[model samples]
Target: MGSGEHDRILDAALAEADTAGLRGKAVTPFLLGRIVELSGGRSLEVNLDLARNNVRVAAEVAIAWAARR
Candidate 1:
């Protein structure tokens, strides 16, 4: 997906995480995995590094989404 749309999805995933009251390290990967699952399947196999990046991206996107709200 394009960066813009990807960011939008990440934002939505973050919102979902917030609504679900998820915390700690697994939240992002869980959200990311769910996003992938909903879109299709697990295209990218999750790993430590990828999970870490997902967490970062989720946080960034979530913050941006919140700012717009």
Candidate 2:
């Protein structure tokens, strides 16, 4: 999804969570679930892609650092 759409979904989810009085540790899961619902599950797919990309980047960084040492 475009960044604008992603931001809109996140803002809407956060607003709903706030209205529902979600706080502390409860907020993360609530927001995630709301985002998924709001985005028609697209958010979850994006999240998984981001996670995998992060792992790949971390491994690349580690390899580069090791080579320099």
Candidate 3:
């Protein structure tokens, strides 16, 4: 899906979660499930991509930091 579609789905899920009074521990799972439903499983793919990117960035940062020691 396009970035705009992803943003729309994520915003809708977040709004629903807010309206439902989801807080703290309840928020993550609720938003994730809602996004999956709204995006027809595309959200999971995006989430995996984001997670991979995060890991990659962290690894790069750690390597840089270690090199500075």
- Candidate 2 lDDT by residue in tens digits, 1-69: 899999999999999999999899999999989899999999889889999999999999999999999
Off by over 4 Å in 2: none
Q: State which candidate has the highest lDDT.
A: 2
| Full ranking by TM-score | 2, 3, 1
Question: How high is the lDDT of residue 17 in model 1?
Answer: 88
Local lDDT at 38 for model 1: 50
> Comparing candidate 1 with candidate 3, which one achieves the higher lDDT?
3
Where does candidate 3 have its weakest 10-residue lDDT segment?
A: 39-48
RMSD of each: 13.4, 1.6, 2.7
Q: Which pairs of residues collide in model 2?
A: none
TM-scores for the candidates: 0.51, 0.78, 0.65
Residues 1-69, candidate 3: write the lDDT tens digits. Answer: 899998999899999999998899999999889989999998789789999999999999999999999
lDDT of 2 at 15: 94
Find the candidate with the highest TM-score and give its number. Answer: 2
